[model samples]
Target chain A: MTDDLPPLLLGRLNHVGIACPSIDDTIAMYARLFGATVSTPPFDLPAQGVRVAFIDVANSQLELIEPLGPDSPIHGFLKKNPAGGQHHVCFEVADIIAARDAMRARGATVLGSGEPRIGAHGVPIIFVHPRDTGGVLIELMATPDHY
Target chain B: MTDDLPPLLLGRLNHVGIACPSIDDTIAMYARLFGATVSTPPFDLPAQGVRVAFIDVANSQLELIEPLGPDSPIHGFLKKNPAGGQHHVCFEVADIIAARDAMRARGATVLGSGEPRIGAHGVPIIFVHPRDTGGVLIELMATPDHY
Candidate 1:
């Protein structure tokens, strides 16, 4: 059955998501230590219930996210890990809907409504459940139009 | 003092380590689902107390690791997470010692003996603690001679 499936086009890793209590502090640390180029001022994503900033590296990015409010999705994660930690990893895909269907056909679980929502990069993204991803929350995002 | 420092040269990400109870199972999943090209057979790294396999991607690799024995460092990780999960992320550096010194100067904690140990890839590698890295266990390795 698996032999009949088409190739899964998991594109390059776009960014790694890090859950931090304070994006400013993390941005400062990255800048001071690694001389990293961090994106200015975290912007709110009410839909995702978090504020996010991007720290650009040579090949990829580190996304720092903080809970937006009490009802934020990452609030529980922050409470459990007050010091912050690696949240999820995002991978780019040329076609998100195709990726979603392929993953689902292979028994991978897609989180939320099983639909791609606009992510911070202004591209459609879907989260694959951790259980199916060997304990990593995997976010599959369509490559931004600009990219 | 920080203003006078040169920019840290963080190379492309090398791989993301996933700790799994069974490398065979994970390899099968990646191959069957993602049509990933996994390295043939898992190799034991007795020094690290783990067996490792690689799944090649376009930009980076996915390292699937399993405990070598009872004393394996990842034994406890698997015990806590029976189903397995993301363990660490590795990045390449031109000079690991210089990277270590810079990180230490900026108050980041290096794990183990604070020295580079020969990693599975046969290169000098050091682990930066998650506490200082926004909760990600970051491995910095000197780029291989061939790379």
Candidate 2:
């Protein structure tokens, strides 16, 4: 049966990124609340100028991201408003290529073009800028299972 | 087969509430992108002094909320910041009654107790003030299905 549904653009939520003042504190809180354990400790994303850590949930994850240096984008965001809060929502897409094209046709801007890049859990991913998508930074990924 | 996984503390995502200067503009943009029409137009929430509308997705929604009066919370939020962006994420719980009790025991404050009210889809819901949830307003609901 060809489901004829608009093709479930997002497979499942890969992760949710939350901006944190300190990963130490956030990790501790998540551990207590959801029994999440630190899977990926703070690592720098030089390209994005931010550091991130992942607290593994059963299938999804909680990513805690902090700015690496003063010039980082996350730092600039923190400068304006320093309250530790949600940064973005990441979804696992069935096909990054098709999903990116579909979103672009719908007037959404794909941050990077070409082959999908690896993210948490070695999943191939792409990012959709907030400017084109109602002010929410959305990440699309293809999980390892699909790959 | 019984999957012993602890059921999601919250059901599927309820909505992503955005505090925009104009709900009409936000609603138009979302409609264009998601290919989903607004389930309802602006309705004033006098208790909060704001107007809200929702764009339904597969199992969740995107909410566009704007301040109705100048003294409203959203009005102040927009004035205080330039990049008035994604405001909050809401999740549906299994039982608002039990969830509220558990959250309170965990040191979280429940905003509107005893008002087990219906939301955009007539599902019972409640809100936990951001003040209690690390400065982010969180909504909890008891929807029928788990997303």
Best by DockQ: 1
How far off is each candidate at the interface, as Cα RMSD in Å? Answer: 2.7, 6.4
Clashing pairs in 1: A85-B135, A134-B85
lDDT of 1 by residue, B85-137 (tens): 77888889999999999889879899989889999789999998888877778
Task: Quote the positional error of residue A5 for candidate 1 in Å.
Answer: 5.6
Model 2 over residues A26-128: C-alpha lDDT tens digits?
Answer: 6665444323457788787776667888865434556788877777667756665576776777776667788878788877888856456776556677788
Give the lDDT of residue A125 in candidate 2.
Answer: 77
Q: Would you estimate the TM-scores of all the predictions?
A: 0.92, 0.71
Per-residue alpha-carbon lDDT of candidate 1 for residues A1-147, written as tens digits (9 for 90 to 100): 255645756778888888899888887766776677675468999999899998766677788999997888898878767888778888899899998998898899999888899999999999988888777788989987764
List chain A TM-scores, every candidate, in order.
Answer: 0.92, 0.79
Q: Model 1: runs farther than 4 Å from truth?
A: A1-5, B1-6
lDDT of each: 0.83, 0.66
Instruction: Categorize the docking of model 1.
Output: medium
What's the C-alpha lDDT at position B135 in model 2? 54
